[model samples]
Target: MSSISRPSAAASAHAETIRFEAADGHPLEGTLTTGPGHGPLALISAATAVKRGFYQKFAESLVTEHGFRAALTYDYRGTGGSVSQDFNPRHISMADWGMKDFPAALARLELVAPGHRVVGVGQSYGGQALGLGNVSERFERYLMVATISGYWRNLGGGFKLYALMNLVANPVAFLVGHVPSGMGLGSGLPGGVFSDWTRWCNRPDYFFSEEPRFDAKNLFASVRTPILAIGATDDPWGTPAAREAIMRHFTNAPVETRWLDPQEAGGPIGHLDFFRSRFRETLWPEAIGWLKGEAQA
Candidate 1:
């Protein structure tokens, strides 16, 4: 076996917990897993409502098995470890998470692993947020897993879930101060975060048509980084059409899109399972090779 190849849980103790300030001055919590040797720095961005911990095992594997110098995972404002303050009703938005929080995470990673090349690995909404963020151009390459625009029509069976968010969860979030934890959205979300997601998913134009807060076309047109977008054939939330919708926004990026069927992944690998530890034997190594520029779509 290679020197760096090891089980994910075996290297958990080596991870270092740290704090970094966001562009907006919000203190964000993160964990940095240092590899056995120096290599590229990886910033693993989590999906919506997903905590930094959700990516811990994946981050550990990247450092322990893939030869990355370090892998950083952080929580967005108002979620997970970043929610150290009283946020009965935090006034944050999805755009803030994309434009502000992600950039801050990038800056933090750059500081933590100076002189090392940076590779961005964004899962689902994590990938969407990176494209919309300001500092994405700083990365050498991007590996976006299950990334897609929140267009309701292209969601296949996921439209029901989006509809419920728009009609039920959103109202409860505004009234109850947070998205209900029992709803199983990885983690409970702030009212504003949930509402903003609903507003974007409910609209046909998604974030592209929104004004004042963002100019999606102009924002993504500047992206020239090589992109590798991986999607699942069985993921209703990130269907092929949905992925295309989001990829269309990155007008300048040379994007390579790949679809993996559950059978090829050894089981029913849906949107969430793409990053699950179980796939470490399958997709994980493929992802690492792709990020290293050792493989192609």
Candidate 2:
């Protein structure tokens, strides 16, 4: 509940580095962007292994540009600022990011902004985590960017099949208990996290394969919030079909998918570009407009 920072008057926004704990009492850290007071909340969840800094501009913009009361962004346990240098990757799993870490962020938002509407933007793996627990129902609306079922088959290339088969399904990842850096996942990921990710990616049903253990079907089906799912034509990992495959599980929610072409963006808007500051003028407004409309409706 402690926030540590002063407002930078120039931007009409302030960022506070706050410390919070998950339901499991797992300590976590994140940044809260807005004024000292609260109004409408914007929870910006990050992609797999993606840190809070990646969304700093977007979070702050929610307050200064989009008229949000506040925005929250954080790191999952065992990744980014939340984990210690000696952290053991084996202690965490991809499921924990949704069921545990995401809920914790929700609770933190609740503490900071009581009796107000909250909107969320879940990017990539973040969008998947939204359906993992009871948190999605709390948001007035949500926008998912580049979120997909990550099924290897949905993607093109025999190289993907070969690479995933030999690299991830083998003993190296299991023995090391982590996907080492330079694997293209940025900063790398805990072995437990990557293993669960591998399992989900291998299945067309993605996380549903972990059924019975987590009640993936009913858990996702329970969400009633309206969702806007965005897919980019250039994103190999989150193709339109791949994104739709996973979002289909939100049977109770009214979902909409909008595909963006790189040509319209004046450049490439890959799986990771939507949040980049350069798109603040082009793509971000589209997201903000949709969220405002949904949350108010």
Candidate 3:
């Protein structure tokens, strides 16, 4: 546990820890950032293996710096403060994260701050979950950052190694009962999570056809909510084709696509860099401004 390790919020001036349950009645934890006289709510959905603390700074920014009335950052079951049971004993997959936890977070946010427009900020796997389990309608606006169909064939250059890593990694996960941290992935993952991730990455349709458990109706076509889908040039996995392959499913949403260049963005904007605090000046303005309807063309 680093400085960001799960804190009980201590009832900070602008943030508070809130405990909620996933759709499965699984216990979960989150932090809510809010202030007086705010507008919409921002929900920060984290990427696979990444914890809610990873998004805490961004969540605070939504309320502190941006116009959002409140922001909620939470961990899916078996991750962060929500991990009540050991990983080896139970099966947990993206479907659990998407179909169950994401909606529960949204419902909790609604309870905490009712009647406000809900905005979603989904990073990588976070973006995929919105369409996976029919939570798109809950968000009046959505932003997808580095969210892509992780099919290795769609990736280019060094990113093609994602598949190789999966080959090497999955076996190790099976042996160890978990996906050890590092090896390019940010955090240690439950064996089931890494299993689902690799299995989906193997398919052209990604999660759409990779798993029978993901049989929920494809809701991407049904989402009328406005979307901002951003691709980073330096991100190997989030290639233009990869991003397009997944986002093209949102037929009904007014999708605005943008590619961020490291030169213009002031630094290398990798897949994980978008949420990092360093880019708060150069990159966040356009992304956050768009939601506030204050973005420049």
Candidate 4:
């Protein structure tokens, strides 16, 4: 048999790159997509395992179809092409993300699209980051898709066991110089991000049990941004009760929650599929309709 050969392509076109100094002074990398008209600036944030390019299709829709002035997406520290391994990997915390990289991204966006209203669209872990970022009045609107504010109680038997393993793996990570496994919905985040996730997962209030710490409650209460929360009826991490719990945290802000059935949204769509689904053609139009204050029911 003949050997297989890799496909060849033309030279790559250059995309604009910008670097921001995070609140903690870490350099963060981002990509900017300028739109054809002056409209609200959209800032897209990705989940832990997802890179900035993960939002490419969505960003295109926001600019070309929705008329958003600009869309900016970035990788968190230690993920994607941003500064990697600059911080301690063994003991990273979500608080560090909220305090550092997220704020830097916001500052950079403000500079790039000065005097424009900003909207945040985040998915999964990225949605959680948006929730944390909402404590400030920086964004004009928020859209959280498949977000987890804390943890889900009923993530099935496999997730339950994975949660148990994370507790043991976190401390071991520090000793072995390995990242904690099972920190993400899938696998393999940076050691620092993984450790932070492990700490949050083991907490009773978020995942393993319901006895959440008082600080966790305060963290939820502090967020005052208006929001549109979206979830799938079949999502394992976003079960009805779990979604409601997340909504309860945003009582201080005006919130609209949408629980979509797969068939209704076009076809069978789960958590990740919501973004990668035809639902955008159908579901997003409705969501955007609601966001534009057009559909009220």
Candidate 5:
């Protein structure tokens, strides 16, 4: 493996733009947040449709607070920095994000910090996708935030029915050949990614229940890394039931599940808010401490 060059110190502390390639040879874009040498390496994976920059502050904190050797945040194919001006969206799928994009990031991390044990800190779909990827064995541990099954029925109130109708986004994607930034829809998702996502959320078992299902069940079951799965009490996408539904797939991983209550910390910690900069004083430190094994679960 070719060594990944570190940027100048000024550029390394914040966002150091980097490029890598997937197994399929698709170019991917990311940023590295560097720390002092000889610390653990980390990869901060973003949620679906969320760009790498969304986790900029969080990635930086891994160095400032947790003393990571370096932290990475990358965009999936056809999104954000990874998408070239001439990129084609017609052929992408959710499986590509898991089985391909994530593994690419893991490979990049290995080259960036050759001997360090890697920690995967993923948010929402980011954490879910990790299990489907083939690189889980490379991770020393996982920090799963707001990551849960979107099976819909596990959610409370009318949200389940609303999620069942998420399939409506698929028709729009088919018509436009890409998902438009419509109400309740993520922008720039490939037609197949959007369709596959809706298909998972609408099913009784999400991705695991699909016919001719992707190999996620087997992949996840094989993971032996320790996992800390955090679900927000107020998060519609990752309720207690939703978290339980998806985490069961990791049959061999020893997972410690925790519910983060925004009420206890004085904020509305929804599905996406847990990683926001505002919580740097609250959930952020708590999570970092957890990953460092500073405290018991």
Candidate 6:
């Protein structure tokens, strides 16, 4: 129901603006990249505070070196370039991204580029959204990096506070049309996204709880696509328990889980740096190797 601006000149050559209708009739914005070679298509979902540009470097790398035909990335409603006129910064919910934004993007891709084997790469909250969306047989494979399956008991200091504020302050902020100054976990998020994230943090089970259940485990169980779950040993957000929780959900999917430490990888790659840093020259090789192996099999 809201208009999304086209990609800027800096990104236009490698990206194109795409519009698609969701099952609920909401309009979704996306970026499509068609590289020179023929291969499977990849869709990238952004983390909580980052936008699609955060994925530009890695998507381009996948396109040029890996021979992928295209990569599609998009912003969920109320974030970055996809803000809606009806968007009340205090009233947004993470469920909107999982149920509406992500599915709409996938449906659009299916319509626009029919018959291509699609792959999804998700990071952090994006990984959660992908997990919530589930990997259907429509996709060739699924890759989850720095993903959190649920919030459970052992989140962290910042996250615990975030959850608390959402329970106590969010409604008050909504009535007053402002978010508390320190409520945001990370920078660059609009008030709506911040509030939505706060709500997730407040809940012990994250997206898997009965109250606002998104059926993440059901999605994983039904996935016919191969999966690769990547986590960093030093990432507090993607702790061992969190990573194991995600793996457990995908019981039926063929999956490989890797725990990477900067020391073991012979680099300083941490959680977010795996996509943003020069370590891609080392890291992507392993990823591509796995992808190729899966393709051959």
Each model's lDDT comes to 0.80, 0.80, 0.77, 0.63, 0.79, 0.67
Per-model clash counts, in order, read: 0, 2, 0, 1, 0, 1
Better of 2 and 3 by TM-score: 2
Instruction: For candidate 5, write residues 27-108 as lDDT tens digits.
Output: 7888877867456788888888788887888887778766778888899988887875455676778888888899999888
Which ranges in model 6 have alpha carbons more than 4 Å from their true place?
1-13, 89-91, 150-152, 156-184, 187-196, 211-214, 292-297
| Candidate 6's TM-score | 0.81
Residues 129-205, candidate 4, lDDT per residue (tens digit)?
65555345777777888776445344433466465546655556666654544544443455656666665654534
Global Cα lDDT for candidate 1: 0.80
Off by over 4 Å in 3: 1-13, 86-90, 157-164, 210-212
Tens digits of per-residue lDDT, candidate 2, 221-247, equal: 999999999988898777666877899
1-297, model 3: which lDDT tens digit per residue? 111334333233277778878766677788877756366788888988788888877776666677578888888877777776644413877678888888988998887577778889999888887887586777888888998887878877444476555668788878876776776676777677778878877778877774355553356677788988888999977888899888888777899998999998888988888888888888887888877667577
Instruction: Output the worst ten-in-a-row residue range by lDDT, candidate 3.
Output: 1-10
Q: Which ten residues in a row have the lowest lDDT in candidate 1?
A: 1-10
**Whose TM-score is higher: candidate 2's or candidate 4's?**
2
User: Which 10 consecutive positions of candidate 2 have the poorest summed lDDT?
Assistant: 162-171
Model 4 C-alpha RMSD vs. true structure (Å) is: 6.7
Pairs with backbone N, CA or C atoms under 3 Å apart (clashes), candidate 5? none
Q: Which prediction has the highest TM-score against the true structure?
A: 1
Ordering by lDDT:
2, 1, 5, 3, 6, 4
TM-score result, candidate 4: 0.81
- Those runs of model 1 whose alpha carbons end farther than 4 Å from true positions after fitting are 1-8, 11-13, 86-88
